[model samples]
Target: MTRIVVLGGTGYAGRHIVAEAVSRGHEVVAVSRSVPTDQVIGAEYVQGSALDVAPLAETLTAADAVVSALSPRGDMTDRALEALTNVAELLSGTSTRLGVVGGAGGSLIAPGGPRLFDQGFPEEYKHEAQVGIDSLAMLETTDSGLDWFFVHPAEVFGPWAEGERTGHYRDGGDVLVRDDEGKSYISGADFAVAVVDEIEQGNHHRERFTVGY
Candidate 1:
């Protein structure tokens, strides 16, 4: 089975990914600052901070892939990039692949021109969105040997609208995935499926992809 480590695994997106990976029989480790009151069965939860990567050396060493489900809010408002960079440096030459969960704001509105962030994005979310964009930039300029992939979720994805798992999703490369009605949405469970699918399939190396209905 694949060994996977998920930072911020107790959060909304991370918890879904952990549950999905564990259900698939993958060895999953959920790392966060605090343990979850309701933990996913078949998954190991660890109390850890992304800011300090040294303590996670042993765990990082054995991981097949490390997914950064980290968010840039609260105490991590401006430090998420630092945490991701540290992990990237630690996994630079190793065989472990680095997977990042980015925001929809960095997604392209069309095929070539404007990004969602470049348009009239909410001022409240601009900071966090900028962090996601910066994280992608850091990955692109990293050492050539590092295996990495970034994933951008649809415009409406969060705990507020936790939809059921339909086991289906469409990928929009560099562009936001929207349905015929011009709506971009993906259930958290299906988004997790996309992430784990990429882990098992190894598609889109060193690039970013989007997921939606």
Candidate 2:
């Protein structure tokens, strides 16, 4: 089984990713500030901030990959980037890969042009979206040399809809994924599938990929 660590594993998207990783029979270590309430059947929970480097390194040392699901609050984007850089530094010489959950703001709305957030995004979410965009920028310029992939979710993402695991979704490049009805969304479960699928298949290295229905 692939040994994996998921930073911020208690949040909405993180929880689903953790569950999906465990369901696929991978060994998982989930780290978050607060402990998770819902018990993931096969994951070891670690309580701590993603900013804690020493503990984060200790958790990542034996892992095959690290999934960063960290969502920065307020102006904590810098702090989040520092933590991610620390993790990348720690895994620099190893074979461990890093897969970050990127934001939709970074995804392209047109070919070689502006992003979604640049087109008058809602003020309420603009800050958070900027953080994700900044994180992706950091990943691109950093000299860590570790294998990394940024997975960007569509405009709408939420808890998994109650149903069988379909493992079906559309994947796209920098552009957003939209359907005929002019809707762009992906179920959390399906998003998790995309993330894990990338982890297993080893595609889209050092780049961002978008997902939707």
Candidate 3:
């Protein structure tokens, strides 16, 4: 079983990913600002801020891979991105692989053209989405020796709908995927499935990929 560490495990998408990882028989260590009293079965939860490097390093030691699902609310996007970058730095020089959760804003709407957020992104989400987009760019330029993969979800994510474990999704190369209704969306459960699938199969290495139903 792979020893995996999940940053921001208490959040919406992170929690789903943690559940999926544990269900697959992988040993998971979840790190967040606060530990859930009712933690997921077969997983270890650690309470710590992602901004702190020492504790994060200690938590991630000997981990097979690290999944970063950390996000900031509103204007805290820059701070959140900085903290995540610090975590990436700590994982450098280790055997751990990094899988980062990216924002739809960074994914291409067209080849070599505008991003999702660029094309009429909601003002309310602009700051946080930009943070995610910037974080993906930072990961791309990181000189650290860590092997990393960035996964971008569709326009709709989180616990908006109760979606079943289809165990199926279509992967796209940096571009967004839309259905017959000319819309793009993914359930948090399906997104978690995609994340764990990548971890187990090791597809889309050292690059970014987008997912949709």
Among these predictions, the greatest lDDT belongs to 1
- For residue 151, model 2's alpha carbon misses the true position, in angstroms, by 0.7
Q: lDDT of all predictions, in order shown? A: 0.95, 0.83, 0.85
Candidate 1 colliding pairs: none
List the candidate numbers ranked by TM-score, top first.
Answer: 1, 3, 2
- lDDT, candidate 3, residue 144? 59
Clashes of each: 0, 0, 0
Per-residue lDDT tens digits of candidate 3, residues 45-159? 9888777768678668678989999888644456888788888888777778999988888888887868898898999888878888888888888775878899999877767
Residue-by-residue lDDT tens digits, candidate 2, 1-213: 999889889877788899999999999999888786786988999887757778666778788899989877644555777777777777777888999997888888878868899888889888778878878887888665678899999888755443335799888788988888978788888899999999999978888899987
Query: How do the candidates rank by lDDT, highest first?
Result: 1, 3, 2
Model 2 misplaced regions, further than 4 Å: 74-78, 159-165
